[model samples]
Target chain A: MSLDKEKIKHVAKLARISVDEAKVASLTKDLNSIFKFIEQLNELNTDKVEPLTSILNQSLRSRKDEISDGKIREKILQNSPKKNEEFFVVPKVVE
Target chain B: MSNITNLSLSEILKSIKSKKISSLELTQAYIKNIENAKKLNAFVTTTFDQALENAKKFDNKPNNEQLLSGVPLAVKDLFCTENVKTTAGSNILNNFIPSYESTVTKNLWNNGAFLLGKLNCDEFAMGSSNETSFFGNVINPVGDHLVPGGSSGGSSSALAADLTPATIGTDTGGSIRQPASFTGTVGFKPTYGLCSRWGIVAFASSLDQAGPMTKTVNDCSIMLEAMSGFDDKDSTSINKKKETYSKNLKDNIKGLKIGIPKEYRVDNMPKEIDELWEKGKKILKDLGAQLIDISLPHTKYALPTYYIVAPAEASSNLARYDGVRYGYRSQKGKDLIEMYENTRSEGFGDEVKRRILIGTYVLSSGYYDAYYLKAQKVRQLIKKDFDDSFTKVDAILTPSTPSSAFKIGEKTNDPVSMYLNDIFTVPVNLAGLPALSLPAGLDKKGYPLGLQLIGKALDEQKILNIGYAFEKNCGYKNEIKKWWS
Candidate 1:
């Protein structure tokens, strides 16, 4: 089943993307086409097939468990659209 | 100085060696081009002054044999560079300057590469057409009205327009190849994980790959060599030792096996590209390479599989842009939720928002097993298609795109048509294999067709060798369409 206009609005709510009322209709159509495409996946017999992560048919590499990332907080915060001294700034949340 | 604008790196090196032009003068010429072509939207931002200033820092400017020593290459806006705006062509990242450099960009700078500017790209590399870019679409140098293809449209357009020598672009699902085909240039997406993705903005993590768009296959190799290497910072990065791209330039293709997937000749595809593929096979066969009929039976499922897998990952990846952190925020909103909604809705282009919705719905709690996990299994089937074919052939050959470049806004209104353009190229990315799009021939419509070569994992050199040989026999020149001129 495809996402209805109501469910799409709910998903937009979840994703934090505001949908214009007019766009909702078109979004509903596009989302349905995609869902139909994805619906084809249901036809595949995957009862026994293992989900593959990398296409090379290999396992992921694991390194020594250690915390090694160094201090670069200042450089990182420089690109923040809005920042408050050491932290990223945003609209006030607390009362 | 031998048209400093479009000269290959080798040609530039020769001029620099002969002292015919100083590195600073060459940088200035490119700077001039960038200034003149800024209206093309080829570059998002140009640090020309900083680049020249860096050129002046070199001790023996002309005497250095730094592969790309003085060449100014444009980077797609996705790669993070310290203090530079890395927007991924979306308003959400409109002011999100990264704090550090991506390993690829850092490697280029370490090799004394002049960072001329960041090229434009589709918003989060999501759209197949450049139309979704927040900075306005990149104008195809060939036809201002026709698309240059996307999401790496700017890189291909930049290279074609001679505004920049070459540019680095990421390919998730034909982003690099389709644009390269459309622009009539070379676009190579090395095996996934060959180039470090550290500090690059995420789209679909598993499929996002950094590669080059340039005038020739050799330039693609030279640029790819500089861009690729292992980095621990990117967990998906391969630990394989770096291979020399230039070492086997003259490799012969006498006994090379080129597979043509049977399902790729689907009836819905444009007949013009199909005709061009026929000619491509004749040329390769005439050149002594054996063309074999191979079955990649799961090819029909590639597009749907990619849509499911890519959007599923895109939804998760784009979730980070919730306005509370580092990106666009709403001017006036009541609560944090409202701010996040307003910011993203206003910040992302329509295509992005559409994908996000699809991604969210598929990966939702109750729907995950039905959509995301099932799609993962389909993805394996798609990979198996290539895996089974590689057993019979050294590499796979097909049209990079079903047709040549379409006009801007042609398919933008219809999402499925836009997705159809990637039919020929998306499978390789889903399988994490190396592939390249080089100039094959032109369609009857006067647009270019690209012959694609898909190689086994980390077998980029093999694909490049095939491309090098194809160019040798076919003698396909970079025939810039008359519309742009």
Candidate 2:
């Protein structure tokens, strides 16, 4: 499970983080070592075991479709780094 | 009232009710103490002026109907405070003020507790030591150079240093208990879903849980009661009535069955920690309790499993922070994708980036079944191991940490070695059980060692009872020597 620069780059791309070329070598080493540590889980025989989603053993409770919140549009927009009135200002996505 | 900050939460409540001390006086004392303990770096944001203003309102007419009327406490910055900056200890959320308060903090306010400030924590609550914080590492109050264990490091440090009477913290894989172990404070992570998680910054939504950090076990119980309840906002919040834990602190452990997990005997464990475990067993055994040897066979996989699951969830949860509606936005980036990449690249710290990468890799198409799915299935096995053991034993006893607080830079370079610090405490979180760490005794370096008592799901009262008995008989209390001052 030795992770290479290509794998690290792919994962970083998927995570939307750009790793500098200078730091890529060390980051690759760290991720490889972490994967090496995690490889021990392969030894466990989990053939029939179900993937655990919630530990509370309670099913998700659905509420009626209604707008209970959103009166604080101004307050919510106050945290935006770039904003115009109520809309969050972002770089143009569509050309 | 000279040493008002020295009094426990219960004592403070009594004094405030009896008119011996006003909320304004108590809050001002804590504000001064926070200033004095500035070197510990426990607080990320101190709301002393707001605290005083609320204290004035409380002094005018104390609300006896509320449980913690006029009590002062610090909240871990992860919990969003309305109109106040809630940094999850990351530059990403440096100026991210919440429009609404976290349900737990709201519960505290409804109980009449005043917020002293926002405490520091690891970036996104990722690291074991507080070193990953964007603010800085919180130094252990016991020794100036040592780390207060994290990611609830600030919460524990503040309580131990008397900067706050009690504090709130979240534990996703030992965040609350480990820091309490390092700082010689009491931290209780109740059953997952016992406290509402609405409005707290998400870090592993499934594993993350809110709890109390305090000077004494009784105070932890009281704070736990005040902070816990069902919230319609958080779907995971338990649908149950809140237990009056402070009133249920029965120290009589006559004929209770305590389990000692043999798998926790790791290789090259410190002699002091080993002796502390033995001492805990003896203390329980002497108090008319039976000690049973139990095997949590999947215990060895807990840390790896937690690392996999938590990061996988964190990567998904953190995807929301793409610099559009929040904290730091990169100045350079022609298009939206570049902006997202650059903003995240610069906003997150190294540890956070590492976890995100690991999560991305694990959840990737080809590797999904091998890593994430396997870890989840193993998680079930781990939980089953606890479920089987609880049928035989009333509670489990173990050392809170492998050793006492280490030097600040000791394990910073190696992430795996740092992750091993949560070994003993992570299993409890994976099982979604309640556990408390009590200051048991001092280690060889004269720093405090903690004894942890693990209980079954929603059985916080049982473990708190065990911790109460241990706290009374352990004869260990933190006597702050004012090292930070």
Name the lDDT of candidate 2. Answer: 0.91
For candidate 1, give the docking quality class from DockQ: medium
Alpha carbon deviation, residue B350, candidate 1 (Å): 1.3
lDDT of 1 by residue, B1-485 (tens): 64787787667766766777777888888887777776678778888778888767663544366667766677889999887778899998888877789999888777667788998889999988798998998888767788889999888888888877778899999999999999888999888889999998999999999988888888888888888898988888888888879666764788889998888887768788888889889877877889999998778778888898898899899999877668887786887777888888888888889888888887888988887888788888888878888888999889899888888889988888899899988998999999999898877767777989999998888889888888877776675642533
Off by over 4 Å in 2: none
Q: Per-residue lDDT tens digits of candidate 2, residues B1-485?
A: 78988888888888898899899999989988889899999999989889999999999987877889998789999999998899999998987888889999999999999788999999999988999999999998888999999999999899988999999999999999999999889999899999998999999999899999988889888899999989999998899987999888899999999999999999989999999999999988888899999999999999999989999999999999999987889998889888999999999999999999888888999999999999999999999999999999999999989989999999999999999999999998888899998888888889988889999999999899888888888888777688766
For candidate 2, give the lDDT of residue B169.
95
- Clashing pairs for predicted structure model 1, backbone only: A16-B341, B142-B484
**Residue B172 CA displacement from its true place in model 1, Å:** 0.1
Clash pairs detected, candidate 2: none
lDDT of 1: 0.83
Q: Candidate 2 - CAPRI tier?
A: high
